[model samples]
Target chain A: MIASLRLRAAVVSIVLLAVFLGAWHLATRSTGTAANMSPEYAKLMGMTATQGKSAMPGPLDVGAKLWEHLRRPFYDNGPNDKGLGIQLAFSLGRVMLGYLIAVAIAIPLGFLIGMSPLMSKALDPFIQILKPISPLAWMPLALYTIKDSSLSAIFVIFICSVWPMLINTAFGVASVRKEWINVARTLEVGNFRRAFTVILPAAAPTILTGMRISIGIAWLVIVAAEMLVGGTGIGYFVWNEWNNLSITNVIIAILLIGLVGMVLDQILARVSRLVTFPE
Target chain B: MSIFDDPFDADSRVNAGCICGQHRSPAEHEHAMSALRCEPVVESQEKRYENVVASAVLRAVFPEATTRRAFLKTVGAATALAAVSQFFPLKTATEAFAEAGTPEKKDLKVGFIPITCATPIIMAAPLGFYAKAGLNVEVVKTAGWAVIRDKTINKEYDAAHMLAPMPIAISLGLGAQPIPFTVPAIENINGQGIVLSMKHKDKRDPKDWKGLKFAIPFDYSMHNYLLRYYLAEHGIDPDTDVQLRSVPPPEMVANLRADNIDGFLAPDNICQRAIYDGVGFLHILSKEIWDGHPCCSFAASREFITSAPNSFAALTRAIVDATAYASKAENRKQIAEAIAPANYINAPVTVLEQVLTGTYADGLGGVKTDPKRVDFDPFPWQSFAVWMLTQMKRWGQIKGDVDYKAVAEQIYLATDTRKVMIEMGLTPPKDSYKSFSVMGKSFDPTKPDDYVASFKIKKAS
Candidate 1:
């Protein structure tokens, strides 16, 4: 019965995907003719017009382009041009560095603030004000002060990712069961030892959840930051393709960004699952 | 600060604390250091820079192009003029190709927007001009003009492709931080067009575009100034009569298609792109407005020029040489082929071919051939910079009085270009201050203030 349920869901997902792709294919198929176009322009825009293809790329075009990208993912032609894999790797490298920095800062500060009611109350307003700011707003200031675009991009990723993890870690640490903490106190376990053994385990799942969210955000910010900075990354690839007016390459980049982001989320989700414990 | 504050004075040249690198006395390098493992290459490169300086100084010194450096008095003046290039961090950096002058830095990054105007700059790589000059140059296509500006300013790029007016604007601090940007060579001339949406194919007159929205690549661009000049000449005030927004060139065509903008004064390929897509029509080329007007240029931060003079020289010479090659009509198709690769402009060969060859569809069902439609002349004229200053003042981008000549000399490095022209056996007009008419009205560069005052439908500064 369980196997049947899995099979049915898979079938439904396949049907939905097929329907989506089919609609996209039909909608973006060539639209207008080059019938009344200028003679010289007509010659240059031959297939793009005479074949009545829409200026926007179709699903098939994206699929073919994506296939091309997937086949050779690490070719580096020059400083401006690199394979999709290389770009993704650059993006992931930046994200991981920034995300780890956030994790390093957030978890400790979050723990100290959560352990003390005074600190939490004092920091709440600042956190509240800072959390809602868009990451890119810091770009100009980062670039001007840091004097480095790539470092500025990484800083943007760090700023956007830190707050969520910090808030979540604080909330998780603060909400740890009072009874379990009291028992640890009753046993007179040392403050540091008791906390690591008792409270840390209790808040592990929640902290992991916070970490998962931060990774998601870090991934999101890197694309936009790379686009702004324009060096080497998935965002740069999308922008470069857009400049080339190659919608096919942009679509392919978009797809790969999604794929990498999903993989990142799934990895964090798996880590969080490992930390979860039932009473 | 007074607008006439003369940021570039003679006293400042001797004592200025610039980040590019300080120059040693000319005699220090003359003896050839024990470190000169490659003295001959360095000396030759120095000779090249000297020729460029001599030619450029010769321009500043004489009105005629043929006054050779042989006349004793002229030669002494030329030596002094060449010495002027030394106090400034340009010549010696180019002289040494070995351990001493070995590019202070190799593996240089250059940024550019993917337009046909950037062909000479982009093609230099595949054509191996940079390599031939002992440079490992990597030219990356940038997202937009703003990013190129930022990346170059941030020191992320050693140099960049910019609109001719952008270096002037940056130096004057019109839109960003006040940094000394140098335009050593103009990349292309007359490569822009006014592209109107398809709906306005019949409404081609400038007077008729009273209420339409228009897009220009940047505020500090020849496109914006040219469009404004063209509009004002037609009695339409650009500011109030029509909307002009700074949109990236790639997005301009899309905006036109979406009816977001009625038209754009943009670089080639974008204009051709619109007509190719059947979404717009080419109304008129910028060349028609002012033939041989400088468009985009090869610009660098003053810091980069001083720090890596040799690399900068090699890069500029490569670009100038490339521009010389691109200027010839016979080699244009092959030049077009070289730049149309995926790593370069990434445009369809036909579009680039049309832009380079000057045979294009008018988007009005007519095939027109205008051979000088988009010309590539590398010399950066001081007068062009002066013209840009006037527009900035005319539009109120710059306030108070301007030391136009001093600013032009500082920003426009016409002297560097003199050598490249000599290398190619071409004589750059020593005094390239040639005046030209725009929209049937003559502009005297010497009287920029009068020119600005003459415009009727101006921004009311």
Candidate 2:
């Protein structure tokens, strides 16, 4: 029975792969044909006049470029020079630092406001006012105040990431059951012990949901912030490619951003599942 | 006692009491006692002990209850204080200014575009010209001319290498907010050229720019106006007869190569790149189209210039020195190498050298060594500014009429820039304004408005 199940799963996977590839092939062929006849595509679609030149490379060419960039990518083209690995590292470093800082401040503060009625009443207006402001609006101020691109970009990420985490954490903490509090009181458990043992464990799933939301926000803001700041990072890479008029590179950067965002969300999902009650 | 403890009698009495409580008795006091018995007593005891420890610890830390409100107030105050202390380093600001001298403001941030005109600024920073002047210069590469103007106007940038017309436009309230600006020095002149794709190299001649799809970096840029003048002189209407789109300098060659654009107006290095790439050709150098037209100038917010005069002078000196170095024949190759590696205009040194040397190849098997190909005259304010004002008037960018001279003076800081030039042993123009013949017709400086109104090309209806 196990062997049959494995065989069925294998067959399903192969069929899905075939469908995906077939669809991709059909789409590319149609787009290529349409592009050749269109006035807009005339510029980028034709063959170069060079002796061995061919038509502008299709999807296969993009795959080759991606593979080449991935392997042995550490080349310094000059002073502001770095490889794809270094660029990705720098981008990820800023995102992680900013995201961690956001969580460190947001979680405790969220708990305080959630646990106390008066505190929540006092702070709710302020959060409501600030949460609606766009991250881009803070960019000019951040640039002048911080006086550095990397720091400014990180600050932008931090500003954008904090709100979702704070909101979610507050909701999570406030929703702890009255029965649990009563049981803690009957046992004469300290407030700190009660919170850690009962409230936090119960709130884990919600807190993880906040983190997942925050990470997504961080990723979204980092690209735009880096583009404005302009240094070494994926955002810079995207801007540089656009400036160079290398649309292929821009598309690649977009793909990389999407892939990374997906992975981060998946990791957060797994963490949430690990902490939540099975039932 | 043995006689009294009868089992059946005792059981019957208890059963009767329970039945009475359930049916006969209206009050249920016995049920409450049973519910209390099922409560977890140990859990409450543990909670009490934990709360006691936590309270003790809190008292040890701070003897005041201060309520959560008071504590939050303290935290809020502390955060405000910490934020102020952490972000603003006023002491460093003074020290940086003091060490650099009053001539320059402390912590200087200079903005530049990715073009040959920005060479002097780039070279000066790494070569420590600003550092020597006691200014800490951070060179930032801007996206385009519009951003440079916006940032400078808003005081986000201390100063910027901007288009010659930008300060004038700002003074006239054209593109930017109406803020007074000053040009401390003319950074460079005649660095711009119009490049055509290699495909149209043979068909479209430099003499004819009317039929082609021409790209200018900005709508109101000096190049756009100059191109318009050029086409009109050749009896072609720039508006209806030709297509003009705004394309950034760096992307010009690619656009040309892609055949999306027939040609574009860009600085010299970009034109050189087209030649090197074997995909484009030089149609007309802007200098050739109009002799000694000002392309870019070093500008600062009027507030910065007035308050920090010494720093302004120091910056002017450094730029002047760099420009002098850049103009020398022997330094051409070195300048190319320095600029080529910077990723601003990532092209070969040879391409840059050709364009920088003023001996441009006309792509149609012709060469011209026009001595006036790239003139770096600092004080031709009247010609360029007046021309810009005229273009503005022509294009209806500025609708209402005002004193042209005052408008020009408000925009052009020629008097201030002349002082710096004199100190550097360069000849400053005696007259603030001058007139010159452009495309075989004399442009009168005195009658600037009339010159604009009399243009043969009809204004957009």
- Number of the top candidate by DockQ? 1
Per-model clash counts, in order, read 7, 23
lDDT by residue for model 2 (B75-163), tens: 65345334443655534543443333465465777888767777777767766667765677777677677667766765667889887
Instruction: Give every prediction's interface RMSD.
Output: 2.3, 9.0
List model 1 lDDT by residue over B334-413, tens digit each: 98898887678878888888889988877666778988888887778888999999999888899989998899989998
**Model 1 chain B worst lDDT run, 10 consecutive residues:** B34-43
Model 1 misplaced stretches (Cα beyond 4 Å): A31-41, B1-103, B423-425
Candidate 2 lDDT over residue span A34-129, tens digit each? 312233222212133222233233466567778877886677654344567777777899999999999999999888878887888888899899
Query: Which pairs of residues have clashing backbones in candidate 1?
Result: A30-A52, A30-A53, A30-A54, B42-B95, B42-B96, B52-B419, B93-B310
Report RMSD (Å) for each prediction in the order shown.
10.8, 34.1
How much is the lDDT of residue B261 in candidate 1?
95
**Predicted model with the maximum TM-score:** 1
